[model samples]
Target: SSAITKSTKIVLNLESLGSLPADEAGPLARYASTIQAQRHDYNGKVLSIRTEDLKSLAIIYDMSPDELTTRLIEWGVLSPGADGSIYTDED
Candidate 1:
C-alpha cells in the first residue's frame, strides 16, 4: 500500500469506498479494482513506483516482486529514472 508514493496522496482523495465486497472470490482483485477507482480523474496512466516500491506492489498482487516490477516496466507504469512523467499504453 505504501508503494503508491506520497504523490498519489496528492492526486487521489482517499476515503473509504464504504462497504466494499470483501467476500468476493479474490479479495485483492476486488480491492484492486476499488482502489484503482479511488483515484480521482485517473485515466489509465502510470503510477509512482520507485525501485523500492516494487515490493509493496508485489505483495499486493501476490506475485514475485521482480515479476510485478518487470510487468510495470513493460506496461510503462514505471520507467527507470524518470521524474514524474505519466505514461499510458496508448502513448
Candidate 2:
C-alpha cells in the first residue's frame, strides 16, 4: 500500500514538473546539478548525508541548505534517512 501510494505521489509530482516556469526552473536546475555532482563524487553512488553535510553542500552550490532541502524534498531528489537526516538514493 505504501509503495503504491509513493508511486502515485511520484507520478503526480512528475506531472507538475512539466508546468514549471523558467524562473522557477533555476533553483531546481541548480539543485539537480548539485545532486549530480555529489553522485559523481561518490562514483555514481548515493552518498548518505547528514544535515550538516547537506548544509555544506548547499554552500557548495551557493544556496541555503534549508531552501535547497525544501526544494529537493519536493522534487524527490532527497529522501529522509532512517535517522531523519536527508540522503540521496542515486546508487
Candidate with top TM-score is 2
Q: Compute each candidate's TM-score over C-alphas.
A: 0.32, 0.36
lDDT of 2 by residue, 1-91 (tens): 1211211221112223334674755554455446557667523223333445555656765777566566656666555455444544433
lDDT of each: 0.40, 0.46
Candidate 2, residue 50: lDDT: 40
Q: How good is model 1 by TM-score?
A: 0.32
Residues 1-91 of candidate 1 have per-residue lDDT tens digits of: 3333434221111122123244422443344455566755344332322444445556876778555544544433344334433223233
Runs off by more than 4 Å, candidate 2 = 1-22, 27-64
As a TM-score, model 2 comes out at 0.36
Off by over 4 Å in 1: 1-52, 80-91
